[model samples]
Target: MSSNRITTLLVANRGEIARRIIRSARALGIRTVAVYSDPDARSPHVLDADLAVALGGTASADSYLRADKIIDAARRAGADAIHPGYGFLSENAEFAESCRRADILFVGPSPESMRSMGLKDQAKAIARRAGVPVLPDAEITGDDPTAWAAAACEVGFPLLVKATAGGGGKGMRRVDDLDTLVDAVAGARREAASSFGNATVFLERYLDKARHIEIQVFGDAHGSAVHLGERECSVQRRHQKVLEEAPSPVVGPELREKMGATAVSLVRELRYLGAGTVEYLLDDRTGEFFFLEMNTRLQVEHPVTEEVTGLDLVALQLRVAQGQALGIEQADVVPRGHAIEVRLYAEDPARGFLPTPGPLHLLEYPERPGLRYEVGVSAPGEVSAYYDPMMAKIIARADSREEAAAALASALDATRIHGLVTNRSFLAALLRDPDFLSGATCTDFLDHHQNLLDPAPATPTVVHLAAGLAASVSRRRAANPATGFAAPGFRTLAAEMLMSAVWQPVGREPIPVAYRLAAPSGDTELVLDLDGTRHRFDLIDLGADTVRVRYDGVDYPCAVATHRDGSIWINDATSQSGWVPEPRLPDRTVLAASAAGPVSEVPGTVVAVLISEGDTVAAGQKLVVLEAMKMEHPALAGADGVVQKINVSVGQYVDAQTELVTIGAEGEA
Candidate 1:
């Protein structure tokens, strides 16, 4: 441990990453402080820190992006350094300079290095100058059609029109032919301008089947740096990575050595300090690689690197920022084992990967070693609409890639998350996909196979019903009391099994579940047979209106609450909260009423509803288009139908469920 390292630190970020940094700092005996916006005052990061100060803003630009507020908060809390997790000011060179001017350590690369690598075009130039391979790109101008065309021709067809200041897959377009180049250029410029305040578009050869690989590089002020191998982040949705793993399935020893050496060379030449990732586009067919861009901050997928390298990246960042040399030599850092990380998001995969924001009614994660979940929300926590929808990063590690994949798969299966819709099942499906398992992936994987990633028609009704039945039986068994019932054996009015059920159907109305139960006698036990599962009930009849039921090796105490309209609401045994009956109506047709339909395919807000009720629309006609998250989804009629209803208007925040128009089959009322 270096004695000169900053003693107290302030994390100028929120959510899981912030909590993660604080945890690392505390383990090193360093006090941690936190700065939060109004929405994140009660966030896990704020709660985990030694001191928390509210920055008092709702939006990112007004809060987290306010460097002055962050500095003030850190100064007031007496924090010696500030850790800009990943986003926000993490890559802001001016912020780093400001911190340096204020004599507060910034736990990242220096301002010079950030400026050198922050610009994509500039970074490519630097890579080229450093004798590193780089994909060719064109100059970006706001109003240069001829230049754009010439650039497109130079880059050839199937090229990418991208915003120079883009991140998170925004302001990007892929043109497969010359005819669409102009429109793509304009669209990319417009989106880029709107997203990052920089509409300047550039051209690059779009490798349709390229593997997204990146190497982790660390540096220090004393001129020492090392590469921590590579991570395969090719599994993406809309250019945003959904899954990442270390020791890329494609990169063997020789390729890893070459990529790692180039990564270290780039950082060392730039005198980079702290933790950073150098992204590359690897030609899977040719085994050639090109420099993508260097992320000048700790990455979201750092856990995979940490798991394989057994290195504390945050700690190293702190030490390096304190002007200590990266003590270990290049040979000291060796990649070991295999690790995989899957991002758990609060998004509805079936509904076009739209954000699902609500209270988390129930959350369960496997707690086994080698399987880690980095999440901020817990049971009763809110998945707010204001922040990113990522719920957690579920990581697993093993001695080999196969074992690691299996571990992650098992961990995902064992996990049970309720309340809000999530991408857990989708991630599991992707991990199990044969192509993904075989390392055949690219940035266009999701675009090519959206149906596979986001399954249509939602989960099957049978599966939901089966899960509901199991939950019901488990709930009932929990309600039984520890002591036996009061009813005597000779009593004429024996105890009756009470079951009040509710049914919640997809795209339909709520229904009631009807079932009969017989109370247990002296010898024979109470049994429940539903959905191919047998349940032996252990009934503990507590006096009054309460009973404890035991099923599936778990005890649940339930209080007989009000029953009406063939519906029963019981106070759950474990949570002490009321559990509504499962909805059972076969077809209530709630999709139209509940405003459930694909609003947009891209990240954008709904601008207008082009269809009206009772209007018969064609299958390919645009119904409603949304704008948010920097993309657009043009809602189209999946099948010819009479327009039944329109749920939203222009300028609504529609991600997945902003139903523009509901279409009913012909002759349907």
Candidate 2:
């Protein structure tokens, strides 16, 4: 039985995935409705849908996760079906069952199938029964402090404490010793509760060096299932996948067949429908693999799969939801070429990938064939703390892995995002890493190859050019052409004199620049002198933000924008950086006696105050842990001293560079 019954489909998610689903549904002649929170009212997903509904909530719990509100919105819009794209209530069994009872089609597996493998522990049990390999794990029970300690002892040291109801590396932590075991479990529980509405967790042996591989499996209303090729998602940080590719370099034809078969067997046992992914952790040393968990929904990296297989997975999902059968056999699904994908996020790679939320003053993405951009952002938009910091996903495909990798690298270079710090340069460096190029990728790739994540240093020439641009922008509103005019907010000087300015880039010392007006005539040109060198440049104004500068015998198209930090950002095709007007005097309040106090590098809430006033702390001792954008960062005391002042407690939200703890010098206090 086959019927394309869906005429109007409502997407209950936001960001890139929502936009992705809407595109696919529209291609099949289905009208799409989008539900958005308050912060996402101006997002691309809202504007992409044929009909938009406001959920009237800034947070996810009140908006997307509210099953009743979503269902009501769907009915109000006269929608025939609903699609939960990956996050929010996508895998909530109760929500799926409610949809079935309401006689509304859900573009996913049946509720029974969702509950079968929704939790990690339950999924492992089912996999074990289906003849798939599984690892030994301890399922944690109710609220006993001693219970957590006992479970950790049983699992041994170097254990992984993960949420049973969560993914995306949100509610997972590692316990290295007895001292941090209790705290790790408690933190994981709190994060799990905040992320998945479930505090249940389990303990398992942590593999330090493992590769993550997943098999894509799809089923229909009829009892039929097939597995697409496997994808390698080993390059990750903090338990979240950063980059992914299909047909892993390490897996040959034989191993690929074996993994696919194992994944399909699980679908046969559960009779799963719609789209799903079976994840496994492969031991790089032994070439053996064990089932990790099964995602009961479409994934964030599905574009890479579509690129290689030449199939529209979202279309298949909609067809299956409409009671369509498997019209093609497994032999018809052959993966050709290679594909790679990278997630572009608004995060500071220099600060441990901390989330940096701000406006997108300038946004330009690569547009070309064989390169797909699944983006859900636009200029003049803010990257809010209310949801994930993902701005877009750039995917590339070619005949070989090297070609695909090179294409993705080129695309990243072509992307330009100003006004907020991002991991763009870090992603480019990763593609060029020697180990990555040699296919020596593992889960700890980022950890072991930390040098690859460092932000590139801006060349001295670029900094000088940026300095000139900054100075010129500050004086853009000059009163007269021939006579030099004073600044509007400042007192006028009797005689026109040369102006001096300074430039300060992050992680480097400040630079001083002396500049004088070149002429009183047509195009304004300035002569800048820095470090005993003089350079002259003529500026051609083009609108307010973008400028065309003729310098060094070439015309450069540069965008000048101000940052949240009161710094000026200058960007071009070859370079992008943030520069601030240098201060004349060094602030003494910013430094401690030993220069080792704990300060927050990112804005976050104090989740744990591990130290108190008057407590003796050693070097490298954890003072507090801050939670921001669903990730935890520990602020450590860098020197031996006593805690003189504790400025933060649990639940106190602080801003970047805010002093959270003050450690007294060893001889004082």
> Poorest 10 consecutive residues of model 2 by lDDT?
486-495
lDDT of each: 0.72, 0.81
Per-model RMSD to reference: 6.8, 4.9
Name the candidate that leads on lDDT: 2
Position 252, candidate 2: lDDT = 91
Task: Report the lDDT tens digits of candidate 2 across residue range 62-142.
Answer: 899999999999999988899999989999999998887777889999888999898999999999999999877898888
User: In model 2, where do residues sit more than 4 Å from their true spots?
Assistant: 1-4, 142-150, 153-157, 457-499, 506-567, 582-626, 634-669
Error of 2 at 131 (Å): 0.8
Regions more than 4 Å wrong, model 1: 1-4, 144-147, 178-183, 446-502, 505-669
Q: What is the lDDT of residue 612 in candidate 2?
A: 75
Instruction: Tell me the TM-score of each prediction against the true structure.
Output: 0.78, 0.86
Q: Write the per-residue lDDT of candidate 1 for residues 599-640, one digit (tens) a residue.
A: 443334665577778888776777876554335556777667
